[model samples]
Target: MRLHEYQAKSVFADAGIPTPDATLASSVDEVVEAAEDIGYPVAVKAQVHVGGRGKAGGIKLAESRDEAEQVADEILGMDLKGYHVDRVLVEEAVDFVNELYVGVTMDRGEGKPVAMVSTKGGVDIESVAEETPDAIAREHIDPAFGMHPYQARKVVYDAGVPRELARDVASVLQTMYQLWDDRDASEVEINPLMVTDDDEIIAADAVMNIDDDALFRQQELAEMEEETFEDDLERKASEYGFDYVRLSGNVGIIGNGAGLVMTTLDLVDYYGGEPANFLDIGGGAKAERVANALDMVFSDENVDAVVFNIFGGITRGDEVAKGINSALEQFDEIPKPVVVRLAGTNAEEGREILNDELVTVEETLEDAVQRTVEYSEEEAQ
Candidate 1:
């Protein structure tokens, strides 16, 4: 689960990481009041789950009450990457001489926690990584030993952090690591760890993502799930026993496993089509689970066509067909076309069962993807 900037900052502050004074506001009046209380030269930042807020004009500096109110009013209802900004964080602006980046994240490939420090901050770290990989320094921590103070120190120093502020930066890294460890977080990042003229370091912006599996042990973090869902469809899908991720495309994708779903997405893209969402029903999904997956996929209006690419190994093809039929019966009318490709166990029987006017069944996976994309393109016109 991804935390909003203010929420992440709150977590950081609790872990003894310094952050600028900030107040959450939902209205122009609240923004003005918060700005007044926090003093002038404040930042009016739109609170959205997505990034690139500044590029979208979701962030602005307001040195006065009138300016603060204006900026807040402008950003409060603006859309940033499809998220409607309902709140703005009014923070006290501080004088800073340099910006740096510090973060700790899980490295699944290495199977360890990696602490990364970069001198190039206040910008997209991905861009920095792609353009100048050497600018960032990394230290991988073993689960048995965990991250040490010296390891954090080495990362910052190697990243070219000022000598005088090395210890402070290392301390912040340690605190960030602690938060990540304590909360069972997948990622904890402090972008633009500001180095003020007075030699004080503060986290200007923070972002964190907690591991969903670990939420069982984290009561407080589990409670934070209320703000995680972007829409009712996603929330409803979570209630079911499937994984769903909404994407901006016309073809809805449903597969039995994560790898299959991902491969389907790649094939769709390769064939000049875009996937609307990623829905994994998991292996050995029953008819009810398949029905739920179909319901969730059709809930998305953008999905012009849906492709069910199931390589039935442990997941029986006939059961998947029954679920599709059930879902079709539930809907009053076929809102969009559905393409199904059932291979492996009982494939022929599954194809026979799905020989209905409601869907088109294909013998090959590539054929199914192509037909789905073609149907979606035809639907567009």
Candidate 2:
């Protein structure tokens, strides 16, 4: 679950991290009042879950009440990356000389949590990593032994942080680590941690994502999942109780396992086709479950064609085929063409049972993916 900037900042401030004083407002009047109370030169920021807010005109500086009203009126009720903005954060602007980045996340390859610090901040860290890999310093922490103060100090030093502020930066890094550990968070980040001319450090932005599995024990964080859904498709996927993720593309993908679904997505990309969604029906899915999955995918306006990639193990190929046939029959007219690639148990029987008019069966995954891409492209044209 991803937390909005205001929520993340609130959590950070409670954990003793220094943050610029900010007020949450849901209207232009509230923003003007907050700006007046917090003094001039405030920032009116859209409270949305997506990034690139500043680039999208979702963030602006307000030096006076008139400016605050203008910014708030423009940002509120605007669509930012498909998310509707209903609130804004009025924050006291900071005057800083330098910006830095600090974050902690799991390094799946290393099987440990990694702490990273970079002097090149206030920008996309991924871009910095790709262009100048040496600019970011990393330290992997073992689960047996949590991150130590020394490790934090070393990371800042290696990142070329100024000596006079290294201690304070290390302290903030340590606190962030503690928060990540105690809250069962998957990631914690502070971009553009500001260094003032007076030698004081303050966090200018916050981005935290909690582990979904760990939310069972973290009740407080679990309650913060209200506005995380990007659209109605996501909310419907949740209601349907399947593993579904919406993506930007025209090909709708469905498989029986997580690995199979991910592989299908990759193959679609390799074939120069964009996948609109990833829907894993899991092991031993019944006809109704498959129908539900199809319904969810077909609801997405971006999906131009559908692909069913099933390598039956515990999942029966014949059952999957029957589900596809049943789901298609429900439509008054075929919503879109479907491509099915079936392997493993009952593969031949499954292929024979499919409705050829609605679905084209391919014996190989590569053939199936390529055909699906072509189908989507044809639909687009």
For candidate 2, give the lDDT of residue 202: 93
Can you give the TM-score per candidate against the true fold? Answer: 0.82, 0.86
Candidate 1 per-residue lDDT, tens place, 307-358, comes to 9999989999899999899889877788889999999998888888984789
Per-residue lDDT of candidate 2, residues 218-263 (tens digit): 8887887774435667777788788887776899999999999999
Candidate 1: C-alpha lDDT: 0.90
Off by over 4 Å in 2: 226-230, 248-251, 269-276, 301-305, 325-338, 373-381
Top-TM-score structure, candidate number: 2
Global lDDT scores for all candidate models = 0.90, 0.90
TM-score of structure candidate 1: 0.82
- Residue 327 in model 2: shift from native, Å? 4.3
Clashing pairs in 1: none
